[model samples]
Each structure stands twice: as C-alpha cells, then as structure tokens.
Target: MANYFVGDIQGCYDELMQLLSKVDFNPSRDQLWAVGDLVARGPGSLPTLKYFQQLDGAANVSLGNHDLHLMAVHAKVKRANPKDKLEALLDSSEINSLIGWLRHQPLHQELPEHKIIMSHAGVPPQWDLNTLRAESLRVTQALQSADYVENLLTKMYTSGSNQWHLEMGELEKRIYCINALTRMRFLHSDGRLDFECKVSPAECKDPDLTPWFALEGKVNQSHTLVFGHWAAVMGEVSSTRIKALDTGCCWGEYLTLWHLEKDEKITQNKLKKS
Candidate 1:
C-alpha cells in the first residue's frame, strides 16, 4: 500500500478529493498523512473534518496552528478569526467530537519503514528527531488533560520570537514546543524561532533570517523530514532530506500530495469560480 502525504489542506475539500482521486486512494489499504491545517481559510471546513474524522485510523495528522486555534475558539479561549471560515464546522453538531479528535492528534508522526518524519512545521534547528517526538508527546498528553482548553490554549497565541530557555517553566516549554511544531518558519541568526516573517526565502530581505532546514548544523538528518504550514515556500527547500509540501491551495494555488515511497509529487489546482 502506498503512503500519500498531503500538504496543508486548510478547508479545501474538493481539491483534497481531486488529489486523492488522482492517486486512487483506498482507505482499507493506503495510508494518508496530513501535514496539518486540516481546517480553516477555505469553504469546506465541516465536510473536511467529517471526511478525515470518519476515516479514523486510515488517516493521520500532525496538528497545525490553525487546528490548534480551532480548539481555542471552540473553548472560548480566543475569538475566532472570521477570515478562517470556520463557522460551518463550529455550527455542526459533530463539532465537539471533531474537536476532540483534532485535539488528541499528535504534533509529530514517524514512518520508520520509509525513514521519514512529519510535522506541521519543520522541526526546530536546536533539536533532533527524538526531542521532537518527546516534545510532541508532551503536547499530546497535555491535550488529553481535562484543563487543556482553559489552561494551555489560552496561553499559546502570542506572536514574535518563541526563544527556548533552560529555565523556562513547564507551560513555557509546552508553548515553545507547540510553536516549533505548528507555527515555525524561519530562525534568526541566533537560532531563535522567528514568527514574524511569512514571505518566501527569495523574497525575504533579511540576510540573517534562514529557513529552519537551511540552518548550519541543525536537524539530525537521520531521516527525511516532511513539513508544510509555510505555503510561500512553494514546495522548495535547500536541503534534499527536507521537503516542503504546502503549495498554497487555500490561496487559489495547487494542492500538493507527496508519494512517500516513490518520492513523487502530484498536485491538483483549486477549482476556479464558475
């Protein structure tokens, strides 16, 4: 059975279906891995959540920033950004169950047979794959806790640098790990996470800013890393072992799907307005 890894879906259900159809996905056999952002910013949040939630074990996801934001919005920890287009999903009766499933989804996933690691955002330049897995497990366990909504979600929405520290508290470390896995894009010259820049590398004027995968002496490189969340990259990375999968489908660009075993990329463009 083939393993297909999809880029940030946001809420583009039709595009997702078209890409899956292109690969002739079979839930009984093939496995689907989502780089995350499974909801928000498109027109099909509810349908998209139902589609994957029902799939259960057939599909796996690494939680993205938007997914975590959806949880916060549901719990009244933060106000929903209307631009995210999440109302339909929030209005559904299954919203609660869907949110539960999403909350429990891990921050990282491994396909050891293929020697690949997947996260919504690239792994931090400071840590190896083992650290990623451990931090991800911490967030996952926190999510499973009874007070996650009020306790953790309320504290994770800040912007700017999420610099790590040895003296950081448990909550601070959790937030750092969450941002590293879900919101990271570039690192400052000092190797600190920079959340401000959203432009592609070529367009970025700051010479000190470097994509996480491009940092010198970063990442363990024991396995290939697959990540999304930064649509501006247009699926380009300086490292051969690290792949960017998001092609900006939610922004009217092509949706990308990676064939893990074949090392192939298949794409489907967004449907134009009729």
Candidate 2:
C-alpha cells in the first residue's frame, strides 16, 4: 500500500494514465493524493475529471485555480478564458457533477499520520501551522457556504503578502484565494507573493522574491509539505519532508509521482506522443 502524490494533471489524461500504469497504481491498496489542477490547458479535460470522479473514494484533491475557474464558468460568474480548453467539460452532461465535486474539495489537506500537508500551491512563508489551519478553515467555510462561492472564486487572483491579516477585505480574500489556488511562484523579501515572476531563478529578479522552500526558517521543520504548482522548481528537492512534483507535465514535460513513506520517486513518465 503506497500513498502516491501526483503533480498538476491539467487535462493530460493520457500522460496521467501512462504514469499510473508505469507505477502500477492500485486503487484498492494505494491512495492517490493529487496536487489539483486536474483539468484545463491540455487535451482531455473531460476524461480527467471523469477519471478522478470515478476514483472518488480512492483519491483526495485540493482545489486548484484552474479547477475553481472551471466552476466559476459553470456558475456563470465568469467567462472562460480563450486559452482555457474547457469547452468540452462545459458541454459535457457530467459538468454539474464534475464541477460540484471540484468545488467541494478543500484547499488544504493535512495528513497527521504522515505529518504532511497537501495543497495545490505552497503555504505562505509567514504563516505557521496554526495560522494555516485557522485560515484554511476560514476559506473552507467561505467556499462551502451556500452564499457566493462563485463570486469568491471569480475574484481570486493577485499578489498577497505572506502574512495573514484579518483586517483585509474582499480584495484580500481574492488575493488569498489566488495565493492558495494559483499565481504563486516567488516570495518577496518581505514574504509578499511576486505574481509577475514565472521564469527560472536565473531570470527572476533577485533580492525581492525567492522560492517558497527558501522560507523554511519560517515554517515548522517537523512537518512535511507536498505541493505541485511550480513545475520549474526541480532542484533543492527533498524526499522525507518536502516535494515539488509538478515537473511541468502539461507543457510536454515529464510527469512525476512520489511515494511519501518510502521517500522514493516511484515513477517519472514522459508525456506520450501527442
């Protein structure tokens, strides 16, 4: 029985299937923990959603920004971006159920036994575990509430400083959602998210923003974190504690999966011929 952590499977159903086969994934024995963004961008969004939906009990997903955007489009709260190839998903008969399951997923998943936390993106450098827990609950409540999750998801996009401030308003909530779901890459010296940087360390502006893992001093050393937003972040990898599995699979890059307890990389499947 293995607990496998997969990277952003953004509509790459074929690649995902190949990777799973390479790893010999056993739904009955192995648990699949996804870093989210299961749909969007790639070729097979519908099948990806259906696959995960079928694996309901065997899998756990944290909501990714793309997933939220898909939901928002369905709710009629936001228009679909031209770049998003989600028309198939929107047109599918299972749209309601697929998006519903995606929306109901939590933003943060904590595994006490493994002492690990899983989310689509990384936790901010300024937040400790306690603060993260509280904030996660707050966001979870807002998303789960019957009020206006679509509005919230539609507004989620920005660069928020690492610190959590209760004094923040709607914009901050949006920023928080972005930071939690997507648009997070570099952290400013003061811990603010640098939403503009998407390049490697060589191209990114120095002295202002650094990788999320660089903020380790701010987080508890005891707990492990498994995340998948930064596909470019490959070096400085950790097995027993921290892992970044999103090796840019959606961009014709390798798809990765890591087994947590064994602290070993189970599979590294390259994308199949398009």
Each prediction's number of clashing residue pairs: 0, 0
> How do the residues 80-154 of candidate 2 rate in per-residue lDDT, one tens digit apiece?
876768888899998988876776778778778978888887777667787677766666676666764544655
For 1-274, candidate 1 gives per-residue lDDT tens digits of 9999999999999999999999999999999999999999999989998999988888989999999999999998888899999988999999999999898799998888878889999788778666677778988999989989767888777554288767777787889999998988889888788878999988989888988877753454577889999999999887778889999999999999999879899999998867
**Residue pairs whose backbone atoms clash in candidate 1:** none
Find the 10 residues in a row with the least total lDDT in model 1.
213-222
Q: Give the TM-score of each candidate.
A: 0.96, 0.89
- Candidate 2, superposed: residue stretches over 4 Å from native: 158-163, 169-174, 217-220, 235-240, 268-274
What overall lDDT, based on C-alpha atoms, would model 1 receive against the true structure? Answer: 0.88
lDDT of 1 at 44: 92
Deviation in Å, model 2, residue 92 alpha carbon: 0.3
Each model's C-alpha lDDT? 0.88, 0.74
